[model samples]
Target: MTASMTGFAAHSLNLDHASVNIDLRSVNQRFLELHFRLGDEFRALEPQLRELINQRLARGKVECRIGLTMPPAATLDNGLNPDILERLAHWQADVLQRLPGSAPLSVNDILRWPGAVQTAALSQDALNEAALAGMRAALDELVESRQREGAKLKQHILDRLAAAEAQVAGLAPLLPALAAAQREKLTERLHEALGEAGHERLAQEIVLAAQKADIDEECSRLATHFAEVRRVLNQAGAVGKRLDFLMQELHREANTLGSKSVAVETSRASLELKVLIEQMREQVQNIE
Candidate 1:
């Protein structure tokens, strides 16, 4: 099924002693645009994450944020650097010997000392693998979210399509009557303007007026365009661009129908078609 460009998904995974959290958000855009917000440690993974997103999505302005958290006491040593502590202890002993009256280092002072504790770097291979797994989970959820929105968009577009089709259908039965009325009115005007000697001119003007008022061709083409819209909607995968183009075509037909309209009902139907097309255009902008 097709998907939408608007969606959001967040996922978190615990791996080893750290947690990897991913947030994905997307919105409609003419093209795929990706941005990442990752902690320094995971910054190098941006390229891989981008590649995965590009493979799955065709259009959107997408943002990805990665948060990594390490528990306070995940390791046995609690991230303490023993070598640095030993060096500090040696320095403190020398200072006490040299200055005799110096206060001993308190437990708070030891804990606050630089290098008293350090965070261990996780294995690169392991972090990468875990991050990739977490990303996959988030992406799967993102796709499902987009798909659900796409389904709603499809229904909305289909509804407008039906309304536009109904407008076109309503115009059909009105055409013959409108055309005859237009011919009679134009003929009367021509007779008044050119007198009885203008019979030839009146006939030509009537035929020309009838031809200008003809919208059957526009209506037929609109029907065909509607059918194509349905077909594209039902087909799988990124269809936003295609649907957008169809919207323009549909709008063109509606405009032409309005221009050729000879009756108030036909003109109103044409206006309604334009309204419906505009609504569909907005919805199709987000289809993927």
Candidate 2:
């Protein structure tokens, strides 16, 4: 299935004392480019996260922003460390014995001591695992979003392909008639210029000129290219580049058809073909 290179996804992981929010966004690009916004604690996982995105996506400029929100001390499951408090109490008593008039330790002073309070926290391994899981979920949703957009783009491209085919078909039946009329006009002009004695030479020149103006080959290649486009759209995975190349080929044929045109209808059909091809190319820029 086709996939667009633009999408957005967000996922949050709530741990014991903190929550991690992962936001992934992508826009069309010629290659896979990753930008990460992770704090020092999560920086180690950047390479792994980039690898995960590469495994799923083919092309885009992707930005991954990780937001970490730590709960307040009031929300934490914390309490004073008994061992540290006891040691501090003993030290304070010794200090009071040495200096008889020394001030007593206040509640704030005791709480301010190192290791005086313990708060619930996740281990490094646990945090890494949770963050990775959240990233995976966000990546999955991003891919799904890209796929939904891709489906719409594919339909639009196919519709344009159908229109182009119709234009090619419409021009096919008119080719012989157009060539005959153009040849008659050319022959008449040649007769006016070269006179009756030059009939044989004029016939030969008309045949050659008619061959040059024949849009049959261009029209045929266009139809073939259109069929290839439909086939590519049906096949699986990363067909954007291929489709882009096909658009060039289609445009080339349309240009050839227009350049060699003799009839107003053929020129208009060529113009129409070009318009449809341009529309498809624009959409193909976002496909993957």
Candidate 3:
């Protein structure tokens, strides 16, 4: 199935003491571009996270943001650090002995001191596992999101492809008529300009002009390119660049068809084919 290079996914994983949150944002690009916005503590995960993303995604500018959200203060104060309490006691005793007029440290002041309380620390291994799990889930959601959008883009391109194909198909039937009419018009003009003195010249000039103005080859090439575009769209993985190349080919054929056109029918068909191909090109830019 076709996938797009644009999507978004956010995931949160709850742990014993905190929660790990991850957000993945992707946008279309010519090559795979990965960026990470991780907290200082989680910076170590970047290398592994980068490798995982590279393995899964083929092309896009992807942004991965990871953060840890701690629990409430009350929940975190699971116990008191005895070392901190003992250190505070020694400091207070020294201060009182140095100045008898100073008051003693209160229970509230002791509890409010830095490092007074400690919670069960989350191990690096646990944090890493939780973060990787969350990232895996987020990536899954991101891929699904991209696939849904890609389905829409594929349908859009297919619709325009049908219209362009119809234009090319319509051109083939009009070629013989267009060539005959152009030759007849040129013959009348040449006959009037040359009269009897240049009969052989008129015949040769009409034939040469008619041959140059024939758009049959251009139409055939356009149809062939259209088929190739459809074929590429159906194949798996990273079809955007290929489809883009085919769009160029389609546009080239359309331009040639227009230049060779000698009648309004062929000219209008050329213009419409260009329009449809441009529309398809716009959607193809997002496909993967």
Candidate 4:
């Protein structure tokens, strides 16, 4: 299916004592570019996260921002650590024996030590796992968003493609008539220049000039390119580069038709073809 390079997805993971929010955004770019705005605790997961993104996306400027929020100390499920309490007690006794009248450690101080509160603080492994899971879920949504946008882009391009095809087709039937008129004009000019003596040479020059004015080859190649674009859009995976190249080819043909214009009809058709090709090219820029 076609995929656009622009999308957004956000996911949140709630752990025992904390919550992680994952936000993934993508925009159009020539290649896969990744930017991370993870907290320090989640920095270790960057490499794995990068791999996951690369596995799923082929092109875009992707940004992943993960925010971590922790509950306040007042709200933690608190409990005492016996080992820490014993160490603090021993140190307090030593200090009292030496200083005789020194102020003792407060009850609040003992309770506030590291590991003092049995806040089910997340372990590294647990946090990492949850972040990864959240990332995966966000990616799923991101891909879906891109696909939906892509569908719209594809339809837009196809509509312009149809218009461009009509422009080319309309010019086809008029070509022979245009060629005949151009030949007669050329023959008249040559006769005026060289009279009866230049008949043979005039016939040769007319043949050469007619070949130059023939837009049949350009039209044929344009139709072929159009078909290829439709085919590419149907197949799976990245197609932006291919579509971009096809746009160049289409533009080239349109320019050729304009350069060789022998009548107002052909010139107008060339202009219309150019406008339609430009529209399709703009839409293709967002495809993947």
lDDT of each: 0.87, 0.88, 0.86, 0.89
In candidate 1 the C-alpha lDDT for residue 90 amounts to 98
The reply for model 3, stretches above 4 Å from the true place, is 73-75, 78-120, 193-201
Tens-digit lDDT track of model 4 for 1-288? 999999999999998767889999999999999999987668999999999999999999999998766666633454566677888899999999999999998878876565554444567788889899999999999999999999999999999999888888888888788888999988887788767776678889778888898888988999998999999999899999999999999999999989988899989999999999999999999997
Among all windows of ten consecutive residues in candidate 2, which has the lowest summed lDDT? Answer: 67-76
Residue 191 in model 3: shift from native, Å? Answer: 2.9
> Using alpha carbons, what is the TM-score of model 4?
0.84
lDDT preference between candidates 3 and 4, better one: 4
Q: What are the runs in model 1 whose C-alpha is more than 4 Å off?
A: 80-121
List clashing residue pairs in candidate 4: none
| RMSD in Å for all candidates | 6.2, 8.1, 6.6, 7.1
TM-score, candidate number 2: 0.83
lDDT of 2: 0.88
Question: For residue 264, what is the lDDT in candidate 4?
Answer: 94
TM-score of every prediction relative to native: 0.84, 0.83, 0.83, 0.84
Clashing pairs counted in every model: 1, 0, 0, 0
Task: List the candidate 2 regions with Cα displacement exceeding 4 Å.
Answer: 73-120, 196-199
